[model samples]
Target: MGLPDYIPVKGSITFLGKDITRWSITDRAKAGLTLAWQLPARYEGISIRDYLRTGTKGCSERDLEESMDFIQMNTTFLDRAIDKSLSGGERKRIELASIYLMKPRLAILDEPDSGVDLLALREVLGLLRLLADQGSGVMVITHREDVAAGCDRSYLMCDGRIVLEGSAGAVKRYFMSQCRPCDGCEVGEVMRRG
Candidate 1:
């Protein structure tokens, strides 16, 4: 689980039950699984409409046009130039919306709340929990304590291996205690901020 056993120098990965060890990034994306980058990836000459069309098969317009509360409302400003215009949080949210469009069985999000605000962070966490509850397996990799707290279960990866795992609360407690002399510094901040 340590970054999903990546071999960066080789640019290969295997996810879930799929041996994507040889699949291209796009191929992996089309296989009922999706990955959101640690930093949101943006398209240069694309509008949100154009981008969504590519991923969603031109269905976003039909669906969003008919309903108002979906991606449209959530991605209020994404319809503009998607190149270098979006804030990190906005781009991340748009990335999440794009992943939602795929209706994937497994979603791998890398630090989805990297630069998001409190409200947006909560929204993302709530949506992730909902996805997991709805029978989608969500694997979120983050160093943020708040993000870990939102997950149903938690695991700690150190030195390229999973060293600790358990309920989220238990993991948090253990992580907090191991930080030494400043038990309050790690978990206390998480509790206080939450």
Candidate 2:
């Protein structure tokens, strides 16, 4: 999640009240900063359990079982390799499961609602809520109207900048009136109004 290019270009990233703008991705992860990517990378031969034990602290089988249950995955997932065989939704849930095991202080999710069905979308939202309830800060990068509306606050980014920030309803209304009519917008770009 801490890829070099992903570093902020303007403002700094403060986590747990500490400035982490200069920290390496590895350093950030060690400090309880975790992310679940939308298009999770495939690990051709890594079993789920082995991959998690390497990435998460205290990731014993028991922890995996508990985390898997949170994501609605059965224990059988532990034995499967995180390869192309698993669907995108499965991979996204598994990544979230790994993040849950980390008990991260802040969780950054990138369009987690993308490429998933409605039922899975609910699981993703529930996981975000659970992380927030656990005292972890949750930052979601999403375009889904419902997902953004479920947040306490929301930001609307345009051209790599935050064009609007407020309650989700306000941002959605503004986007509809201001951005939705732009000729450059992809037909699929509008937030799916809930």
Clashes of each: 0, 0
Writing each residue's lDDT as its tens digit, candidate 2 over 37-74 gives: 76776777989888778776656678889988988889
lDDT digits (tens) for residues 1-194 of candidate 1: 22344446654466766578878768877777777777776587787766666676657565543322333344444467787756675676667666666677788777777788887788778767665665667788776777877776677554344557676677767767774442222112211101
Best by TM-score: 2
Q: In model 1, where is the ten-residue run with the lowest total lDDT?
A: 185-194
lDDT of 2 at 55: 76
Candidate with top lDDT is 2
lDDT for model 1 comes to 0.63
- The clash tally of candidate 2 reads 0
Residue 70: error of model 1 in Å?
3.8
Candidate 1 stretches greater than 4 Å from native: 1-18, 58-60, 64-68, 71-78, 83-85, 178-194
Candidate 2: list runs displaced more than 4 Å.
1-11, 180-194
